[model samples]
Target chain A: MTDFKVKGKVWLITDNNGELINDIDTDQIFHNQFLHITEISEMGEHTFGNLEGWENFPEKCNPGDIVFAGSNFGAGSSRQQAVDCFEALGIKAIVAESYGAIYKRNAINSGFPILIFQQINNFVKDDAIKNLDEIEIDFLAGELKNISSGKIFKINPFSKVQKDIMEKGSLLTI
Target chain B: MPGKTVIEKIFTNHSKEDISPGKIVWIDLDVVTARDFGGPNVVKNFHKNYEGQSVFDQSKVFFTFDLTVPPKTIQYANNQMICRKFAKEKGVKVFDIDKGIGTHTLIENGLVPSGSIVVGTDSHMNILGAVNSFGQGMGDVDIAFGFRYGRTWFEVPETVKVKIKGNSSYDYSAKDLVIKALSILRTDKILGKAVEFYGDPIEKLDLPERITFLSMITEMGGIVGFIPFNNNTENEIKKMSGLDNIVPEIKADGDASYSEIIDLDISDIESMVSAPPYPHNGMKVSDLEKVNVDFGFVGSCTNGRIEDILKVWTILKGKKIKEGVQLSIVPATIEVYKQAFEKGILKDLLDAGAIIANPGCGGCAQGHIGMTGKGEVMVSTGNRNFPGKQGDGFNYLTSPEVVAFSVLNGFISDREF
Candidate 1:
């Protein structure tokens, strides 16, 4: 029931929190061109959210958008519900510098495309509002290209099998 | 030639042919466990994907609803409902709610045999390695594949032989020793390796203490951890499981191959504590200076055993917890609670100002019960002090003895006793 095609602009999320989520920081360090750095409110059940005046994220993100963040973005308790909620809200790919071990495994098994990039925070900042047209991800090249800005970021691409699963939407379909 | 170790010997004996690291060979599974938290997902995925009429083997599948049961329990009941439905539909063997023993205890009691390779969806599934079984936590996809095909692939891990020699004083428990060991050897050192605990000091500890030691091995990121089965272990297994005359393989051959061997003389190991942000960042209690504490938690699979409770009781006897320090004690299982009650340890803990919680992984999971407030400092007996792990606070990982002493002293204490 989930869509597999990667479309739309990439917005990178940075790890402004300054710690590893699951010992990996793929979101913050790896896919910065497609990253969006937003101030997350530590409110309710969610760990990170928009700072003041930016709570409407569901409207901000569209289909085929990519998200990047700091280390341990999805760290803490093993609740797949968070992933389910994110998927429902239209997140396509998640690239981070690191992730919680269990969270990384859970996200992959659930059919999300996660790329681990080392040293992501150094390239991107939380204040930048990335335009969607500037980003392109080449799975084979292990890179995320910024077409508008002409910036290319290196990445560790998914394995062939993992790519196949992502293309098919989720492992559930495969 | 590589040196032989206990893990290598066991793997070779069980392997169908000569094997090496990264080789994927099909072997018999000794045990498979499913908990309510993620078991239903595995079953659902298996039924949807697997083209089969029946399970691979009924005996190998062990089910229990530990964390989330119902209103009487700590967390929600939805996960348990799904698990119960799946068990009924498949006619799977399961342990009931009140009768449900902890997965680690149940496996050790008899559901899992010795010299077996076990996998579960729960991350802490490595707890089963206490009885010399090779156990690891897998994702739901892996479980579905395992259920459908009755086999799962694994890269044979290089083995690490940890030889412990000499005896420790009665006050020093395995909990203290493991914290000390992890402090010396960070989680990265044992990554993708199997750590086999052996030697004279291992024999000196009782089954509960041994289980406590093996329970936290996953904190070091080891693939699997274990201790060889012996007569003493067999007797304890029989006593709990009511199985008679069951003897398992004891010691591996002297020439067993191993990737590395590390020897330790821990007879003089004092109590240790792993401070916040990392489990391997440990320090001797004697070296730590006193710091203000807001919370003290004494429970979790790591330290909720009866012996741990007795130790806490010894420290809390005839004294109340320091004012403003909130202490919560969660028994690992109902059986453990009953044992504590039988020995009057429960009353002592309650009288000493500790709130008693039901048997399950509470505060440890940070879902409900004893979540740390922002900027609060807590001393706990749980494993893993990673950021936001025990709530938005600084969590210090230590033994039950240290937790008790901290509760009494109102700060991090360096006292030997």
Candidate 2:
């Protein structure tokens, strides 16, 4: 089984005004022009290619980085490239207020970690979280520790099937 | 007895253990499918894990090609060739370019049974919910797993009950009703939940109209939208399948618990239009400033059925599209195309100076013919108005009546109620 505890740098998917971005659909995360590329390794460079102010996210992100977004993180189409592109960049996890229903299924079945943070509005209000901050997450414990801000918060933990799928890395393996 | 929503009842019929929201359960799948866009990836993953193996049941699986059906580029052709080879070698069926959108093919051809589960690669597969079925879209590997095992895991979703009351006095279509729902509910009101539509207005909708309303649930973030099966639903099923009892007599109990119950009144609803950046960003048609539309399209799984085509024909019958305005019409399936041709609907549209494309999803993607240029405005009947969906142009989503009137005027306009 993989590590239940993960520590990585957090990159906030926000607007120029520093507010959390909501409804960042699949098209913005990975544009339709790159749907032809089947190989996961080649998907990293095109992450956020269609979104303004974040087109160079692939070049700026580091391995084992974590991401934070607002409601409906993957709102549009069920193209797996939206989730696969982040895996190609070695993202540890994605924390959002909520997600599109099918997008959550696609992420869970692929063994990618997408956690729910319901109180993210409070974090946004206080400006408690910043980009490139260090954070630690425990999947089973439902805990989040923001080392940069010296704060700890409770999160929604994994479901029975999600925990099982992550251990095997995908539904096919399990 | 206590109450259960349509989703709970459907899962109870297919699953082993007790069912509830947030409880993960493995359920039997009645139908499994993939299309050209993601079919090849699913095939590759299937072989990688279950090498030299046959699918769980060949009859349950199919490949439908609607996206770039004619193979616009060499890469696309190569991808389709892989699916064709795999389907042939595995003795699986293929609804090739001759067919229309895979989702429509399944419903119109009666491949999907009501009150059952179906999985596919297209996100809009939730359209099956129009017929009281539980349909969902998943990734390549997940679908691959379904192909091998014929079962998949699903967490029962909490349902929201929407009671639609008050028939509008204005002569409106399903498009107007759905637009009114979006404007009232916005995007996230029903996120991660199921919507059970209940009311007299809902029961009166025809099969095509029911599909048109439920197809937009994807934009609302609902997993699926269910309308209790009525006499019309059963009649349509019987006609399509040519069999009796295709639609099961199942429904949510009267006392079912819903996360939220909303009463949507449509008595005074007005004609609506959605502008670019998001399809739910709607405004009254009369309030929108007139914008020149160089490109126009009327076809997609959302509203490309026979009824929608008939609406366009009635409007454009002896009238020509304005000069310099290029309008394209595509039927959703071959059956629809054949019917239109036999009834002389295609001739009337052609006489109105409209270009009639084959029955497939030609105008919905960049690989198709309807992509627009920078600063150009396009008024379409497709479900989405997301950027880059039809290329660099600004996209506006509206009803066929609105589109027909807009194209005739060479600008954004709506038909009188």
Candidate No. with top DockQ: 2
Q: Lowest summed lDDT over 10 consecutive residues: which window, candidate 2 chain A? A: A121-130
Native-interface RMSD of candidate 2: 1.2
DockQ, cand. 2: 0.72
Quote the lDDT for A122 in model 1: 60
Report the CAPRI category for model 2.
Answer: medium
Over 4 Å off in model 2, which ranges? none
Instruction: Report the C-alpha lDDT of model 1 over A1-174, residue by residue, as the tens digit.
Output: 433335447655323453223342121111111111111121112212322222355567676677766454543333444354456556677777755554565666667777767666665642222535546666656787666677777888776555656667555555
Residues B144-216, candidate 2, lDDT per residue (tens digit)?
9999999999888999999999866777778878887877777788888889988987877888888888888
lDDT tens digits, residues B69-142, model 1?
33234233555666677667667777655533355556535765656677765566666666666666665666
True-vs-predicted CA distance for residue A58, candidate 2, Å? 1.3
Q: What TM-score, to 2 decimal places, does chain A of model 1 have?
A: 0.65
Question: In order of the candidates, what TM-score does chain B achieve?
Answer: 0.90, 0.97
Candidate 1 chain B — worst ten consecutive residues by lDDT sum?
B67-76
lDDT of 2 at B171: 74
Residue pairs of candidate 2 with colliding backbone atoms: none
